[model samples]
Target: MSASDNKIVNQENKNSADIITWREYEALRNEMRREFRTNDDELKSTVDEIKQTLDATNVTVTGLSDQMTDIQRNIADMRLAIENLTVLQQQQQEDDDDPELEDDAHNARGAPRGHRPRGWVPLGRNGRGQDEEDGLGKPKFSIPKFEGGADVEEYLTWELKIEKLWSLHPHYSEDRKIKLASSEFDGYALRWWDSLVRNLDEDGAQPIRTWRAMKEAMTSRFVPTNYMRNIFDKLTLLRQGVKTVDEYYMEMEMLMQRGRVRESLEMTMQRFLNGLKYDVKGIVRHYTYTNMNQLLHHAREAESQLAEEAKVKGRATGAGRFTPRSFYSAGAFDALHSLLYSA
Candidate 1:
């Protein structure tokens, strides 16, 4: 009876222990599931934070890309600007090289192809038709164009025409034309020409007011200067030598200017005709020339023909001067030589 009771009690105790262990195991399993759930939630939060960081980094990268694109555009614009500036500099350099665009103050570097130089443009502002300051800082005046002349009135007239072309301002008066007309000529007269000049008044002490007055004064004192003495002298002396017709005519024109004489075209033509040598004058004397230009043209033509005739004569002399008697003489000698050989 005691052993059965003890065995049953032990079994009941064992069953109770098993029930307690089962309940503890169930609680541990619930706690482990809660811890796992908490860890998974923390991991999910870390993943979300990483995703947010990646999104922010992507946004920054997009902004940087936009900035880089802007930088590239700015660089391209600068390159374009530099290229345009280079083109402008090249254009300016080309303009500077152009003859027409060269500084007008330089005038011409040298005379035109075949023509003799007109006048040397003095260095600096002197040749720009500008008023120059003298040593004492005073305004120095000079004739714009006075090569050299004996006739004061004609010379002044020519200078006035040049002044008009330059549109130069005059020192004397506000009006350029009136100032030129009233310019003093006595000061500019050369020694060779002025030596013969005599004053107008009885005492000859007073200065003339203008060039016109000076000219009138001279006219009274030196009307043609010994009558036709100088005129006839020049006409007789004038002759065209090796100089071209233009050069010859220029010399005659200068003579005319010196004498203060203006002849009609016909009178000039006759003067030129009378001055020529025998052969040349004879050819020109027959034509009733209306203009000196026409006479010069015909005279040049005759001169050319005479030159050709002389050249033909020279050629004929050169070809036949020391030649043998005939080509037939050489042939006769050859025939005699053959006959001798045959004998």
Candidate 2:
């Protein structure tokens, strides 16, 4: 009886122990699963935060790129504007012939009334810078009287002076310009203008309303018909003569400008060559010259060389006159031999 009871009790005890072990193992597995779920949720939240940060960063980068592009475009527009302004300034300089009218007499806005600075003169109703209050100041300059004449040079000089004066006072109206120039006319020129005006009124034609029209009328009447032909004839017969190369070149250039003659570089060079003295031209023709300046430079060298040779010959002849006669010289011996043979 005791052995069996003890065996049964032991079996029951073992079964209880096995049940307890299984319960503990099940509780541990459930705890581990809950911990894994918590960790997985935290990882998902972290990943979402990282994705949001990347999206914000991308938007910021795109905005910065657009701003950079706009800045570049603005810079290009500014550069183009500078280039155009520079071109305009250069053209203005060329047209004005570097006149002293570049300084501003007053501000961009009109000057206050009754402010007259030193060396500043008021514009005139009849002519430039006459004593009158036009509310503007210009540097004082004189316009010469044209007074019609047979001297074409006089007319040309007067016209040039008028044009330069007008360039200084570009704000002048066309009618003002015509009247200002007409006021300076005297002698035959005044009579011509008066006669032209009367003829215009009689024909009911508009009088010379612009400076350009006035110039055309005056030039046609004052410039002789054969004046241009005379210039051409002189050019055709022009030669260096006693003048130096520089003098000849300047005269030729002046004549060409007066005639408004345009020629190819080769043709101009040939004309210049043909006008040179024979000795200089012979040396210059043998050399290769591409431009007129080069030709002129070579011609001058040739002239100088010829001049030096002539000076040396003069010096040698003078020295020989001072020295005693040398009968042993080849030329003297030949002469002496000829004389003896003829005798």
Candidate 3:
């Protein structure tokens, strides 16, 4: 009873210890597996969030890039518009010479006979009086006339009078007047005469033969053609080299200073005109500005009027408010301003 009973009790104690150890191990393993599952789910969620952020960032970058491209395109277009306007202005300047030819042609006809010539001469024979015949008889060209009472009759009487005056004037030698008229009108005689009505209206002159006389008087007052040609050459050179408005302004300012002329605010404006001319000749083919031409014309008028006023006043009057030179400067300022401020 003593030895056998003690051995059995020891064995039972060992068996109980082994069973408890096995249960503890199983519980620890289950806890570890649950923790790993939680960590894995957290990692997947973090990765998905990062991917979403990356996609959003890409979309934003792409949109910004597209907007930048559009802005660049607009800038190019504006540049082109400015360039085309310049070329048009140059063409107009060249055409200014044509009007002189018309004056010479009018003078060459000599005195109008007190009566119409024999052939195709309507001596009030077309059932109209002399005045009415004069109105209807000359080759009727449908042309624009002044808004006032300057119709066909008025124009015909004026033309006849001018011819008579040309014949009588001390300076008008028959041959010289003919040559001068021919040289002045050249290819543009009829067209120049047609344009005279508008010119007269603008200048506040009455539509009469005296209009031609006034023009001839003015032409005589100008410096020779060669002097103007030299001015044109220099202007053209300066216009072509300037890339930016600022550069152009500086050059013009220098010119004014050298000429001993007070720097006009209109100089700034002239720079703008030059910029437009440059843009027209250089950039217009590549880019388009719808109103560039009109802007250029306005600038030109402002410059011309300012210059005239300066001449009349005996000094620079508008210099403080708008420097005549300012016209030239405005072109560059506008270009840069557009580039910076535009959306």
Candidate 1 versus truth, CA RMSD in Å, comes to 31.5
Cα RMSDs, all models: 31.5, 21.0, 33.7
Give the per-residue lDDT of model 1 (tens digit) for 1-343: 6999999999999998776577889999999999999999999999999999999999999999999999998997797688656644543454345443244324455556554444332333433222211111112354444334455455546554645543643322222322333343344444323443333344545435344554455455434455446665875689887766567778787667656567777778777776665676677666666777788887877777777999999999888764445655668767877899999
When sorted by lDDT, best at the front, the candidate numbers are: 2, 1, 3
For residues 1-343, write the lDDT of model 3, one tens digit per residue. Answer: 7999999999999998777576788898999999999998999999999999999999999999999999998887786666545533432342234343234333433437563333322324432223222222222222222222323333334334445545554333332333333333322344555476578879956443333554454333322455445544555456634344345546654444323244345554444455554434343334333453444445445445545766978655545566636865779767777899995
Q: Tell me the deviation in Å of residue 297 in model 3.
A: 52
Report the lDDT tens digits of candidate 2 across residue range 1-343. Answer: 6999999999999998777576889999999999999999999999999999999999999999999999998887797688656644543453234233322233212566676555554444432334322322322565689889888988877887898899987755564577678877899999999999999989957667678999889878977768879888889999999999999999998888666589999989999999999999999988888898899999999999999999999999887673324555537778878999999
What's the CA RMSD of model 3 in angstroms?
Answer: 33.7
Every model's TM-score: 0.36, 0.50, 0.25
Best by TM-score: 2
**Residue 131, model 3, lDDT:** 28
Q: Identify the leading candidate in terms of lDDT.
A: 2
The parts of candidate 3 lying over 4 Å away from their true place are: 1-20, 96-343
